[model samples]
Target: MFDSEIRYIISSGQRKKPICQNIVLLQQWLLEQGRCVVCGSFLTKGEKKPFGTGLKIICSCNQVYFYLPLANLYKRLSQNLYKL
Candidate 1:
């Protein structure tokens, strides 16, 4: 498994429109499985993109946000497993 640091940034444009910027270490695995965790929409991973080291997840609703680390995802999964 590949371990990399991921970071996210939210920007508000002049029109009050919100845009998300993600910077993370590029990994082949993440590039291959391009899908938003919240919306289940396909995400794009650009190569050699110097924005910084993680995956960016965006949704059309603009009501969802993810600020957790990758480990947190696994942690949540484990917690749910106990309930099953």
Candidate 2:
């Protein structure tokens, strides 16, 4: 459900994107689920503050999942262009 919502945000491509906060929320949700995001074995949250615009999580399968905002990516790029 959460993953699907993130995908929807990407597919929408309108004016909304998955922000860092949203990703954080997703991580929390996944933690509650107690399931890995990669192999669905088990989930282990890494203790690290959100840097830039992404979150990092490790699964029991030794798989790492990084959640980054979708729309914010382009928005950030456009902002950078304006600075140039």
> Which candidate leads the pack in TM-score?
2
| CA lDDT of each prediction against the hidden true structure | 0.30, 0.46
* Candidate 2 lDDT by residue in tens digits, 1-84: 787575546524666555665676665665456555445454334332244576444444545444454532211122223222
Please, what is the TM-score per model?
A: 0.22, 0.29
Off by over 4 Å in 1: 1-32, 45-50, 53-84
How many residue pairs clash in all the candidates, one count each?
5, 0
Predictions: Cα RMSD each: 17.6, 13.5
TM-score of 2: 0.29
- The local distance difference test score of model 1 is 0.30
- State the lDDT of candidate 1 residue by residue for 37-57, as single tens digits: 444444432121121132223
lDDT of 2: 0.46
lDDT minimum window of 10 residues, candidate 1: 46-55
lDDT over C-alpha atoms for residue 18 of model 2: 53
